[model samples]
Target: MISFEAVAISMQGRTLVRDISLSVMAGEKVVLRGRSGSGKSTLLKAVVGGTPITAGAIRVGSLAVVPENIQRIRQEIAYISQEPGMSRETAAEDLLLPFTFKAHSGKEPTAAQIEAVLDRLLLDPAILRQKSATLSGGEKQRLVIARAILLDKRIFLADEITSALDAESKDAVFSFLLESDHTVLSISHDPEWIGRCSRVFTIENGILREEK
Candidate 1:
């Protein structure tokens, strides 16, 4: 679950958003929609402590998103972006490379598990051996998602993840994130994606409003 109470994001004297309050319960699929520069991305980034909130608080599950808890919160959330950064020289097989870091050393996924996610995402397991620089944008996005699922994280913060995907790939991603065990908070303007979510919130003129 994610909670934002009276959250405000202000930068360089230009207020991005203010007095925002929202709660996404466990096992729920929610999406945030807004016009360009409406602060939807800012609010989503705050949930993972990537952006600082000027007022109120943001919490993930049982932990507050503070300096002390940021690391733990990040470990629990898979923040997928429109263009996830990947090393040009690395092979796709090294998708789980982050697990090599001290903090995630013991969390690497098994070979069989990696194969399963690849199948579920409709990706060719053989692509795992391809150089990261050679993969298309859609391919990279899917691999990023596969890595997150293999990490066993329950919460997903997706920012226009389907932008580069084809219709079929988009559906695969939608189903993967909307599964019963996962909780999703996505930033998307796609109507199909919006329709698939259980609830919708739109940011307008620096305020957050629910579609209800």
Candidate 2:
């Protein structure tokens, strides 16, 4: 489970999230919807330990997202931002980049696994050889998601990943994520995306409010 109690986040002396508490169980999909700059993305970043909390507590499963436990928490969760950073030139290399890290070394997936994930996302196998910079926004989004799937992460924090996807691609991506056993905390404004969530949260003036 993911739990946040009395969580408050302040950056540069300005509070972006104030005393927010939320809980989401495994396999539960939740979306945060609100006007832009309303702290939706900030809350997601806080859960993943990318943003420091000024107060309160955060726990993902039994591991708390404190400075001491950050490494462990990072290993268990996958955070996808709107613009994914790919250091490699080719798509396949980008997908396999994590394995190059010491923690994931020697766990690089087989070619068959990569192909299977791309196929599931409706991406052409030829894209594997394409330059990452040449791909469109929608293609990049799908590729990042495919990489996350190959890593076998149990928790996903998605920030407007489908904003640039077409209807068919969006459906394909959503279908893949929803079918997984992972817990999801997403920041999205798309109506279809919001409708797919099991729970909805809204943020206003740094306060979190459950919509349903």
For model 2, residues 1-212, the per-residue Cα lDDT tens digits are 89999999888899888888999999999998888988888788887787889899999998888888888888778888777787789988888888889988999888889889999999999998999899877788888888888888889998998877877677777987766778999988888888888999988888888985
In angstroms, the error of model 2 at 114 is 1.4
Clash list (residue pairs), candidate 1: none
The per-prediction CA RMSD against the true structure, in angstroms, equals 1.4, 1.3
List where candidate 2 sits over 4 angstroms from the true fold.
none
Report the backbone clash tally of model 1: 0
Predicted structure 1, TM vs. truth: 0.95
Compared with the true structure, model 2 gives a TM-score of 0.95
Which digits, one per residue and each the tens of the lDDT, describe model 1 over residues 56-90?
98889889999999888988888888877887466
Residue 69's lDDT within candidate 1 is 90
Q: What is the lDDT of residue 105 in candidate 1?
A: 86
| Residue-level lDDT for 205 in candidate 1 | 93
